[model samples]
Target: EAEVAQSPRYKITEKSQAVAFWCDPISGHATLYWYRQILGQGPELLVQFQDESVVDDSQLPKDRFSAERLKGVDSTLKIQPAELGDSAMYLCASSLVNRGDAFFGQGTRLTVV
Candidate 1:
């Protein structure tokens, strides 16, 4: 199926290093979102972008996590000085607007030690 793309389905990293992941949304979609899902928890919105502009990033940890959708097509997320508590499932989703169900990628699982 034509779908979203993500890299490094799993990652292992030291607690103080940096890591990055990438995502590509389906064609013709205009809204993109980044979410963090801890084990046994619902997905939490980290950031949202409308086209090339950031719409919401209230939950994102600016000191450790950052994300961007520059061209508004694909996006990248980075975590610097990773913490053990940062270990979780980083998911990427895309939708036509902010109100509907979004198509989700398999996610990148980060494990910090």
Candidate 2:
């Protein structure tokens, strides 16, 4: 069975350091998304990409965070000068069609100290 792939399932970094997470969506999926889920809260969309173009990123903290889906396939999310408040589960999801049932990866848990 195909699945979204995420790396470094766990990460710990000091405040002001940089951190990055990677994801590879299931083959043939066209819609990819990045989400941040703080403990005790529902996931919040950080960015959504349809193919290689960004569709939405209103909630993303663009000053310190960024995401990209180069070639419309695998993607990477990065945070510069990571802050303690950035500690959370970063999830990657994909779907075959817009608003379809998305498959999610085992999220990368980030901890900034």
Candidate 3:
């Protein structure tokens, strides 16, 4: 089975620094999502995309965070001047139209000092 692609599984940075993460969803999947999980909290939707179009991004912290999906296949998330509160598990997930179960990558954990 093909695996989801992710990079820099762990990241450590000082507060007010910039950080970014990348992900590639499974081939043929139409929907992709980015979620933020804060320790004990469940993953919260940060953004959702259908193909190359963004479906929802109401929960995203537009002030410091931005995300995009290019060509509807690969995606990237960037945070400028990162804050200590931004430390968490940033998960990328995707699902096919017929499949409701989203497959998640191990996630990129960010730690800000």
Stretches > 4 Å off in candidate 2: none
Q: Where does candidate 2 clash, by residue pair?
A: none
**Compared with the true structure, what per-residue lDDT tens digits does model 2 show for residues 1-113?**
99999998999999999999999999999999999999999999999999999999999999999999889999999999899999999999999975679999999999999
Count: clashes, candidate 3: 0
Q: Whole-model Cα lDDT per candidate? A: 0.93, 0.96, 0.92
TM-score of 3: 0.95
lDDT winner between 1 and 3, please give it: 1
Candidates in order: C-alpha RMSD to true structure: 1.0, 0.8, 0.9
Count of clashes, each model: 0, 0, 0
Candidate 1 per-residue lDDT, tens place, 1-113, comes to: 77999988999999999999899998878998899999999999999988889999999999999898889999999999999999999999999974697999999999999
Model 3, residue 105: distance off in Å is 0.6
Give each model a TM-score.
Answer: 0.96, 0.97, 0.95
Top-scoring candidate (TM-score): 2
Question: TM-score for model 2?
Answer: 0.97
Candidate 3 has an lDDT of 0.92
Per-residue lDDT for 1-113 in model 3, tens only?
96677777999999999999999988988899999999999999999999988999999999999999978999999999899999999999999977799988889999999
